[model samples]
Target: MTTTDAVRPTGPGLGAVLSDAELAAVRADFPLLGRTVRGGRPLVYLDSAATSQKPSVVLEAEVDFYEQRNAAVHRGAHQLAEEATEAFEAAREAVAAFVGAGAGEIVWTPGATAAINLVAYAFSNATAGRGGAAAEPFRLVPGDEIVVTAAEHHANLVPWQELCARTGAVLRWFGVTDDGRLDLSNLDEVITERTRVVAFAHVSNVTGAVAPVAELLAAARRVGAYTVLDACQSVPNLPVDLPALGVDFAAFSGHKLLGPTGVGALYGRRELLEAMPPVTTGGSMVEVVTMEATTYAPPPQRFEAGTQMVAQAVGMGVAAQWLGELGMEAVAAHERELAAELVKIAEIPGVRVIGPVDTADRLAVVSFVVDGVHAHDVGQVLDDRGIAVRVGHHCAQPLHRRFGVAATARASASVYTTADEIIAFREALAGVRAFFGVD
Candidate 1:
């Protein structure tokens, strides 16, 4: 068949998922989308997985917090301090509800990477017996194993590697299939009795493939291993329910979910958080402090050391409310339509899609490589046409190695993405090979 014929037909127009009026309203909510670039060409933003554009409501929420309720939380007995503390905890409750978790289960962090490191360091502390009797459940020994997957982002992989290095635990991983799906065929073998933890991504950032959560959870449960989900990609695109998924802990970033940067959340089972040792200890996290010893606060507060990201958390709460109001079902349906159109990039000559060709168990992230052109060159051509895409391993160096490529050009979708924007992406991509003299 000709390359054009290989292209899957585009979905029912963007209107099928979002009506033209709805799309217009959504775009209007995000101020940055209206701007032009590269000498006045309209910007076609397809890099949501890297970081999403904040809506006006999210921006306003942050500014309002700074303007009205600007004070340290859980500190003073003054009115402003009480107000700020109320707002901060309220934001935590809102974020908890968004993930089907309890308010006490959510711990604020700088970002998802920090959250993972927090858990990893807690393990290290437990192994070192620094957390006293309460953290015995997390202690690791030399024979203990930590299971991860080959497709994990570096944030997920590196922390576990460091934890194993510190604790004398072994690190093993599930492999990726040729189609970019997780290879769970030998699940029993990988997650054995010696396994202490199982950490994996809910949705891969590089391949856009959704992991088999139920299967993975079952394996971990069978072996009595703790499960840590990297929900950085899934929480933004899918309806994520941590409690329902039965994961012991999960981490996701606010920025990827239409909130501001420098704020993320770590959702732990309440009991686990109570048992897990605090990685950072300082002011606000303590209940009593003497020069000789210190007593810590409760679960959520204990993990939040020093000054908190009050405004950022408030903005993230608003972002969660905005997505909740829109309804995750509608958002998922809209992105599925975009994914269908995006996979057709494979139809272009010399272009090879690095992930699943269909949109079944995937987000709207499409990564591809030209036969002879470098990924950066491909990104430059797309940028010249006002199409913004991510060009790199996307923090999944091992996954890129699995595909035998150094890097890929990735275009991801968000709620604001339209049918026309995707079409423009495809048109711009079609010219990449020829522009680089590889056509």
Candidate 2:
């Protein structure tokens, strides 16, 4: 376990160049990759699952807002307000196009967690008969079941757990296999006649296993259940189409896709979002307010209450455009190459990759445990060399329990990750055992 060979370089293996030219150039736009850390150690950032580094385009979009049109959006007759509102809505359109969704189908929230919570809260209100007409489709009773998975991050799991607790609905979940894929063989039992809502992650955060969305959706559809997908991990890395995925609702974070933090989107079918009750009430969401009753606006605006994250949304829109320019298929292909190389490193002696070994069906978010060493110590060793990775259970305690470990060391890749960086990460990991005198 001595430090020797590094992880393989993420670029083309040998003399030949990568076919994706735009992806090669994408590294230049992220300013952070240019900097050195830990007294001149070249920075290797592989924690895109937590938050992606911003490209210049996204940064400039936010800066442009502050400089040229720093005014409130949607609630203004003034010149600056009009300008701001136009830019904001343009951003919204950009996001909608990125996901193959309509402007009305998208609602901005604080982040993925908030977006998911908004839906959950709305569903809760609907079930309780508290949201008036909007509550019609969401009413679940005592025998109703909400389906989730052991692999879901807390954002997707906790809300439903709370919803079930509040509504007296039964909660059922798919378990995780040893390789970290969801055990969906019991789909019939897990999503039964009692299931009113079915929610799960598109790709597991800890395992990187891409769930069988088509099959999962079909099972839910068979049971007449509403589907909610947590796309926080997948949306940033892959080409996501909600209409194609056939989910009733989807949520993702902007920060994980190189946009600023504090903004994310919830994508619900136009009719579904319109029928769902507003979780937060006040301000622009309302169309008409009387002393006794108030009527809310339509879909996107109705879900978006209070002040909006104009700058964040604008930045996210730019991020989406930037990714679109590169082509999502190319992005997916580039990362698959990186994952293939990184998986080789995990196969080395004393390394145990946490997820499915199949590269074709996974994201680049690989987690693993190194023999004779704690993940925290390994993370510190890599951090000392300026290689950033995520370490721990990754907010999926049930998943970790299935793996028979409390925590793991994760190395996630983005469009910017190079083969050399992955190599350096592996080399650093090889040194961990020796650094701690464990070998």
Candidate 3:
């Protein structure tokens, strides 16, 4: 067959160069890909949206950390300590460059959830009218409103809800449209002068809809509201440059982006991070302490309390470098092809996709429901076939409620996903109706 014919025959009718050899090469880089599941079925991991499989490069980096450079950082007296500190700080610079921010602006946290809570808790302090010399800009008061969206994951929503309850500030949010896109029509009305903080997801975890970030930031700027973006989904799947986006704060996870768990980074504009009080106070975060009074370190260190996840940070840094080497443009192109395939699967009979079919404006997260088949059952059938997918609310209960469904089966793709895997997923999903004896 000719090259054009080979490419054109692929599913979703897209013209892209996806070779089995290329996919095989990529698969070899993941140690888990060589393993089997359910006794002897080759794993077809389609749940990158939940957490990605780590590459060998990232794994080896973690191993190297413990084997060669295992020591405490920031307070070192000897050679190994110095090496550990250097590696840890280099990891910070790598993370900073990963999302287009300064090294000093990146604060290490346990995960995206912790990072988001840091921002929310700091705002809670502000709402209580607590301010010293450094805490002036974060102050929020009664009648102040915080704006979010109905599509936010619980990590993004619950913190703001708790903040509102603690501070007497009203919590407002933009609802979803019938098509599963965020209804920004009420942008002006929702983000008024009373709105002190505006927190939203960069990409909906359920709908995969990309928010109008520029427009949203413009609205928030007019009202002088602090903007906090939950980039847990976007940073892993898209080319994110937080500095250029002009958000005051952002957070994302390392595990979702091909790194280890227990390590994530929060990016705050230096001035903003400096102005907000640390949510968790402990040994490393303090500058000096007396029986009566205590002083805290500036910005990043202030927010980072207790012992750091040194090895995980180094591994994440390697993952960031790996993604950087492959180039975000290449990763985006690969997932775009995968998204097109997912859209086609959604078009199958008795299948109802939960979000917009437009692949251009969204990431590769595809949530859908099979007629008369429970999401858990659908997930089980796929699992029996060695395909992994996320079933249930995917941690966005409000979004599921908006779609008028109790649950959904989500298949998310990443740079490693191939067209053949998508095809296998579709075929497996097709078997669900017949097996369940549903129309």
Best by TM-score: 1
For residues 1-439, write the lDDT of model 1, one tens digit per residue. Answer: 1111111212234224666777788788899999999999999999999999988888887887888889998889999899888878878887899899999999999999999999999999888987789999899999899999999999999999999999899999999998899999998899999999999999999889999999999989999999999999999877889999999999999999999999999999999999988889888888899999888888999899999999999888878877766667778889899999999998998889998988799999999998899999999999999999999999999999999999999999998899899999999889887887877
Residues 1-439 of candidate 2 have per-residue lDDT tens digits of 0001111123433323346454556777888889999899889998999899998878878887899898988887999999888888888888889899998899999999999999889988888786687678798788799999999999999999999998989889999888878898898989888999999999998989999999989999998999999999998888889898899999999999889999999999998988888889999999999999998898899988888998999888888877766667767878888888788767667889988887879989999998989999889999999999999999998888888889999999998898788998989888888888877
Candidate 2 positional error at 191, Å: 0.6
Model 3, position 96, has a per-residue lDDT of 91
Cα lDDT over the full model 1? 0.90
**lDDT comparing candidate 2 with the true structure:** 0.86
TM-score for every candidate vs. truth? 0.96, 0.95, 0.94
Worst 10 residues of 3 by lDDT: 1-10
What stretches of model 3 exceed 4 Å from their correct place?
A: 1-22, 129-131
* Residue 86's lDDT in candidate 1: 83
| Model number with the top lDDT | 1
Question: What is the lDDT, from 0 to 100, of the residue 357 in candidate 2?
Answer: 82
